[model samples]
Target: MLVKMYYNIKIIIFKLACFKLALPADGATGEHEDTSQPRQVTSTRRTQVSVRGPDSPKIRGEVHAPIRGLKCLCTNAHSMGNKQEELALLLADTNPDIVGLTETWWESTHDWAVNIKGYRLFRWDRKGRKGRGVAPYVKKQYTSLPNSVGSEDGQTEMLWVRIQGGQGQRDLMVGVYYQLPNQGEELDWEFSGQLVETVKSRDVVIMGDLNYPDNCWEEQSARSDRSHRFLAEIQDLYLTQEVHSPTRANALLDLVLATGNDLVRGLQVLDHLGDSDHCLLEFTIQLRVSKACSKAAALDFRRADFNELRRLVGEALRSQRVRELRI
Candidate 1:
């Protein structure tokens, strides 16, 4: 079993780096959970109007109806270059309820730069660095709004949001991070610990360009000490990784880690936009019903009315014996 998992990881990682991971029939790195009873496949109702964007017409998948939790899209926009219009159109077409953008490379002062119609944006920008920022976009239709928790970690860019989507879902928490490459140092375990501590007692989704890879998870050590600590810190939080496909330049730097199996209804790796090196992680958030699914009760047929049947059988046998003697 261990060998099979490692083998799968190796094969998927290789394909991810090549940017070839797509479609389940094409062997994408997706292991969808199906045990939940309340989960339903998303229906794509045909529309007459034309939607603008490169990926809009191409976007097709099982998107759940937003009666519960909303659909979510995560990506690293990487400085918001020529792909801004393309990315916005893709979101507008797909109609995800929430979207997370990391490495935005835009400062908070440039609020007018981002334009996605009908959605309220929550963002945290980096002033000093040339390439650092994080934020989530919540759709207007959602009743429970999301609030920014601020970047509690100083060393790396970290962003957290409290998504209040009424009760029964327990309110979802999302943490975004951009751990820049070649920092010449290890991850601050203290700060990582604080990120985990903040999302306690809630259904959380931690998604970003984590920038740590583990071709080495099988060895109990990683390609770098950096990855080793990353795996450890997340494990301490009991968050399972939902997005395993490679996000950028064939490495699985981008990820979506959540608290339970049913939180993410679906996930896909999309083609990169314009000159961006990273692809998109398109995923959906299963509503409250899917999250709270309980197995139906069963009955044991063998335990039913056996004693009464035995008595009736004995009476029948005695009557048969008496009739045989008379004959």
Candidate 2:
């Protein structure tokens, strides 16, 4: 019985081995069964990304105050007589405190034609000639007077005006000049003399088409002798040329010169007017006008008219009751 039992045990072991061998291998069927723990599948298409650190700064916009001061607009209206409507439109749009125009092409015949409303016109029309004129329009509220100084031959056209400032502001001397491209040194000398005298008195702002393309305003140098002398004079007077960009075809012919750095701000070269080749210049004159004082008296309760006030109130109440009853 012991032998039979041992043989049966061997047979059972052989059958178990055969059954284990018949089973599939671990990866032969293209399947995985990880009972211990799930495996992480590696991917070759993964991309690396970066994140901002805690020290990174947050982006924001800058805040600035609104510009409040005297605004001025200047342009070279090659022939302003024919472009009056365009100038009018521009004045209406900008509403500047002062307007300066060079090459106005005005004569005695345009006396009544070039006047703009709400502005006191100070013009220097070319005498015995056709082209090359300068005009400055000061607002009517300010007291402005023409102080023109030019040659008898009308070679140097300079329109000088003294503008009375408001209560705390200083009076300003504004000059509008137009130098002929081919003008001789005599005209330049005359203009420089007058300019020096004007600057010696009060603060001055000179705006116009000076026709000095040879000037390098940034470097404060000039190629031509004429422009060199002019630059030297400007530097001696401690004046600053505010316009940087080109106003005409690849040349900064239009200029806005001021006595002090604080005198001018926000200088921009705008589009051309009419058929003119030069661009418009707009800037702020860093000056303020005081508000006009009104003569208004406040109510005084010490001298009360209570009896009349009560009577009016009673009448108004009775009238309101009558109207409500009628309704």
Give the top-scoring candidate (lDDT).
2
Model 2 CA lDDT for position 169 = 43
TM-score of 1: 0.62
Instruction: Give per-residue CA lDDT, model 2, range 35-80, as digits (tens).
Output: 4422222222233211111111111111112224678999899998
Task: Show model 2 residue runs off by greater than 4 Å.
Answer: 1-68, 148-154, 288-327
- Against the unseen true structure, what C-alpha lDDT does each candidate score? 0.61, 0.72
Give the TM-score (vs. native) of candidate 2.
0.65
**Least well predicted 10-residue stretch by lDDT in candidate 1:** 49-58
Candidate 2 Cα deviation (angstroms), residue 129 = 1.8
- The TM-scores, one per candidate, come to 0.62, 0.65
* lDDT (tens digit, per residue) of candidate 1 on 238-297: 767787667776688888878877887679998875677888888877645323333343
